[model samples]
Target chain A: MSLETGTGAASDPAAAPEEAAEADSLGDLSEFDVSSLAYGAVGTTVFLALWQAAALAVGRTYLLPSPIEVATAFVVELTAPTTFTVPFVGASLPATRLTANLLQSLLHYLPGLVVGSVLGIALGVGMGWSGRLDDALTPVTRFLRPIPPLAWIVFAIVWIGIGHGGAAFIVGIGAFWINFYNAYAGVEGVSTHLREVAASLGVDDDLTMIRKVVLPAATPSIATGIRTSIGQCWMIVVAAELFGAPGVGFQIINAAQNLATDVSVAYMAVISLVFLVSDGAFRRVERRVLAWRD
Target chain B: MAGLSEPSASEPRSDDAKVVVDGVGKVYESERQRVRALSGVDFTVDDGEFVCLVGPSGCGKTTLFRTIAGLEAATDGEIRLDGDPVTGPGTDRGMVFQEYGLFPWRTVRENVAFGLEEQGVPEPERSSRVGEMLGLVGLAEFADAYPKELSGGMKQRVGIARALAVDPEILLADEPFGSVDAQTRDMLHEELLRIWSETEKTVLFVTHDVEEAVKLSDRVVVMAADPGRVSEIVDVDLDRPRERTEPAFADYVDRIRTLIGE
Candidate 1:
């Protein structure tokens, strides 16, 4: 026992001396650790400095507005109501508030995201677990998964009649495939040995086994799928609304045609801001759910 | 089919055998060829007996273990527990895996309670049984700890506790100590013995290690590869706390090694 403790206490004698020597040379002050927040601050500062230099070099607000101009445009866009002309009806629509546009985008985005993710995960898990189902679904998914989300816009316009529903259809398609592949890979990647372990412990039935073992084991992958879709769906929302909808994307396009480039940049910034908030919120929840990983 | 903790009246009284392996064989068939993993394997583990299946790399010990556990069906013959045909994994048979297949998401206590929960044991009683199992494995202090935080030996102990939670008539262990360090393996062997005596459950341990078989087993079944079949059965009447350095222990090891064509 004494010998064991002796070895443990002097486990790294060679390293210990070097550490002492280094400590003497360095004095009592500890090494400065660059935290994530500090790194973010430095990165933001560098980015703004470069942007300001570029704006000064261009000296053209219409081409590339200065940071100050864009900031001022952001404030104007945040408070101002937006209007769209109905070309076919020959009538001007009522001016919609910025908050209303944001809500309009979410109206479709959330439903599209929830429904698509739920269906994708369900299909992925079902096909992965059952050999018969996998065979039947493989070819269908293979053919469909390759088609891009934007490619569905024509169908969305025809089927959904060009509204928030149409935009949601496009967004849903994008989220679906991402979540499908992730969930599929997750379920497929589960260790066969772990299944046997579950069986040995009396988790014999298929449904119970899936619930008790397979789902929990595949959670990390499923969580990754959900988080990825959160960001991917946001990208689709901005692009999906380019047709005709009350969202930040439509606002950007409307501003750009009028030579209000700063307003366009402001809308783009709002998209980025919205994405950051959602992604950050998701990460916090993801960390809690996958606490077992830590 | 019954509560594993209580032995029924019809439980194999005359046979005194907890497990009976009768001419069991498992064959895997693919497109090109048919591979016979266990060909005409026969063995029996009596109630409260400590038996070890020792063999070389390609041996069907693991295959046979799985067959008994009912995780894999024998292509020929059958395995019986308490004189009833073994269909699939039930509360009556529990297993310990080599890789320590404890659910990383669950605490040690929850893991121990897993089988019991499956058995539909409820509330306060389940908690008490979990407590007892943790105490039995000497992991009571670490009940709330996750599998990731425990050492290899501790994880194996939790595995054992989980298996024993449902009070299975037989415990099948596939190289349970294979991953632990040498000193920890020795400590686990002793802990297993103590638990075995205390619980009085029949143990069917499979390993490639000859010394481990000699040190722990009441009877060691030696197996060979190439169609994978049992070649010999050696009875180890060695006393408790058997030393690896002893000549008798060395002889037993030599015998098993020779039997497996080592």
Candidate 2:
């Protein structure tokens, strides 16, 4: 009783070594888990080793490029300038590196992602809430869902010409289906009790009930749909550009046509890098919007 | 139960009652089977009276309560409130659910202000009412907290605050204390009684607990399970601040249990 642990008292000596040991165990990679980072590094090292072994055995860059050759080609693509066509404006513009390529690809990707997502969610909510709309749209959706997004390439080229509009149309179709099912399931999954609660609280009207109760309750699902489409659109964008558009995918095809596999692989890696950065940015935004889920 | 003097005066007269549930019945029929939730269930609550509809799980007390709340339509008879037939959910009736139906996405203050917003009350008055209701439920300090951040008892308190925020003529609470622990249930019972006496709004509380019924109700209407009929109505004439440990309190609980054939 004589000794007291007063406010802002001196720290315990026994805990100092424990804290020091903890700090020593976790020196760097503080932002991420150290063991998981180690495992990822190990995985990449193993993959590169296997790839190098195969390349050395073949002893040919044209057929199978080494990791070093591909890395050097990647740096060249990052810095080199090239000639390209501006899709809608019909102007041939000189641009440097992957920057212009990514920007042009985004010009198509952004519009397609937005338009497809908006239309899909709107239609999905309508189908879920009203039986008549569901019956009318269900048959058409089932027929369209079977056709691959790539099949739209011929129609896209025919309708909008082989340009950014054509590529964007293909990306839009891919994004449409991803968001459609999610938004439909989201609205349908709204709990009956929640609707009853809304009714008892003076929100008996159909419009207010959907807006205040159904939408907020289904937001987690809707947000997930948007996130999934963000990545799916990226996949469609590269393929859409591969057919006949000016972007990283076109760069890959042009290099491969000249039997330069290293350059093709370099551009493929660039697309992956872009996807990683964009997906990471999206995750941060999604977390903030869906904070209620926590 | 111990007989009290002049129980008839406390009985709800059709002309003077706040809620008159006359021969109300609810039947749910599907292709597979026909289920009757309530049959010939009749009751009335006088103006400002605190009544509890006590029954077992399948007794259809909830169906009857929902009918009065205007969430469900009765297949037979009508529920008249203030001489008007209950058509649908309106501003005149506020309901508290067992699961504390406060929207998880909304803050405590916003949840309480939901009905007010629906009624189109202006910002100044709405804020004042929300502040008052939160204070009444002792949740003024936690006004900005979400429902997920609260305990079971506090969530129900938010539900009560939200229901009373609109100042309805009748408060319908369907097992408001059902999710809370026993200790918190006792505390909520006291809080509900205080709020009821202060607001003077007629309350139709539904619960399966016999002790809760005897403690809170001016009258407890025991319901039967099969066919969901009204078995017997027990007149609880206990004085204010009735103690659960008292012999008379035990007698009232036992009388209701026997009436329901428990």
Candidate 3:
């Protein structure tokens, strides 16, 4: 009986040469469609118009400041607080101001954003990579995750005093969990077959395999976490400032105490603007880092 | 599938006949029941031979491949590669699963170079070898493409190329073309044969298609479930570029079918 040994290119020289040619017919990589951009533009425009209309309807600036008043207040507060003057319908309205207060607010916001994000990412990656660690730490994480960031204010003030530390602590509490959950979920979501592929290829050790394979595979999820954490950071910034410190939240509270509703609404507008800018920056970074995902 | 004259009495044993599985059996325990995946599965694949294990679904073909690859432990009997027992997955044996297990995140070049990278091959050499393997699979242009972007057939080809790039002693494939369409499967079979002939790596391929087994194997080992065991070992005495409709091909197929009570 003859055997089909398979090692016979030299012995039999005339198989289908066309198959190799046909392999070349595959198409080039295509780009994402522009339809998504159209959808996004339409959604954003509708949201902005609705927000402006709602503010106008509320009328009592303190309860809900109109968009135009907030814009005018923001312009006046931002320009040369040394000689700040508000412009309203071709008339100037002099107002009380504090530029140093903006800097104080930023001090709290920046530290909380950086510290909370770093710790959260590290904790999440650690928990994700080790099942033992996950078992040991999950209860603590779940217990803490459900508690609101503001709930930590009492402890923050008791431990670190009632200024920047307390506010930063609250902000960190808010940002930390968003990043932690995302990173953990990302690592857990890594494909089993991909891990097997790595193992079968001689990357049998967990550490090396994680560094080489799991880390990159889980990056998209981690990136999502970072983006979400940025939004959370902004949300907590005002809340943290509201607790004490002299940021935008404190300014809003002060305006309310003085019964100046328009000024309070103006600060809220600034917060929204800051959030939009931060979101834009994050979107740019996401595009560059995840370019390979396409 | 035309038959050839039998080897002469003085004919020397081909160099490819090196893999020896002597009375191998595997029994897996699942909670409360014992499933026999293979029993007395004996076969010898020459050093560079291409053997296909063909059987119906739930048969022990896949179990045998896994056992040989050292991915699954055998319950009874031994499998010797060259002359050593396979303890675990090593560089000596490369495997290709039916699902192209390419990392979706990595580029085509990276997936092909994964094993080499694990071996700690230098960067320059790794890059060159990756390029060469990609070329071999006719995917050189897609070196930077992600796995998600490739067609099913293309992904499987990369899987095969990745397995081969490591220069393993044997390739254990578990229904490697099972996920693709009929046309793609036929194309892959041809491409596989071409690669096998060129590289001369010992291959133990698993498949449920009778015609595929006849076309690709020097020896088609038929298997059955329900206390899984080797039903028949049919020597495919057909020449290269096999024609499926030939009488000898039908005879070999009939023999296997009869042995399996099909």
TM-score of chain A of each: 0.82, 0.85, 0.73
Please name the candidate that would achieve the greatest DockQ relative to the true structure: 2
Per-model i-RMS: 1.4, 1.4, 1.8
**lDDT against the true structure, each candidate:** 0.84, 0.84, 0.78
Cα error, candidate 2, residue A159 (Å): 1.7
Best by lDDT: 2
Q: Count the backbone clashes (under 3 Å) in each candidate.
A: 0, 0, 9
Question: Model 3 over residues A61-151: C-alpha lDDT tens digits?
Answer: 6776666776677677776444322213344444345454555666677778778877887899899989999999999998889999888
Better of 2 and 3 by DockQ: 2
Model 1 lDDT tens row, A229-275: 99899888888888886677888888888888998898888888888
lDDT of 2 by residue, B100-186 (tens): 877878989999999899889999999999999998999999998888899999999999999899899989999989988999999
lDDT of 1 by residue, B17-75 (tens): 67778888888999999888988887777778888998888778888888888888889
Q: DockQ for every model, please.
A: 0.59, 0.65, 0.40
Model 2 lDDT tens row, A1-294: 102231112245555665645554454335356568789999999999999999999998889999999999988877789766666678877876777777778888989999989888888888877779999989999999888888899999889987778988988898888888888999999888778877877786779988998888888888888889888888888888888777778878888899999988988898888888888998898777766565
- Using TM-score as the measure, what is the rank order of every candidate, best first? 2, 1, 3
lDDT ranking of the models: 2, 1, 3
Say which candidate scores most in TM-score. Answer: 2
Task: Name the weakest run of 10 consecutive residues (lDDT summed) in model 3 chain B.
Answer: B1-10
Provide the TM-score for each candidate, comma-separated: 0.88, 0.91, 0.82
- Runs in model 2 deviating more than 4 A are A1-32, A82-95, B1-12
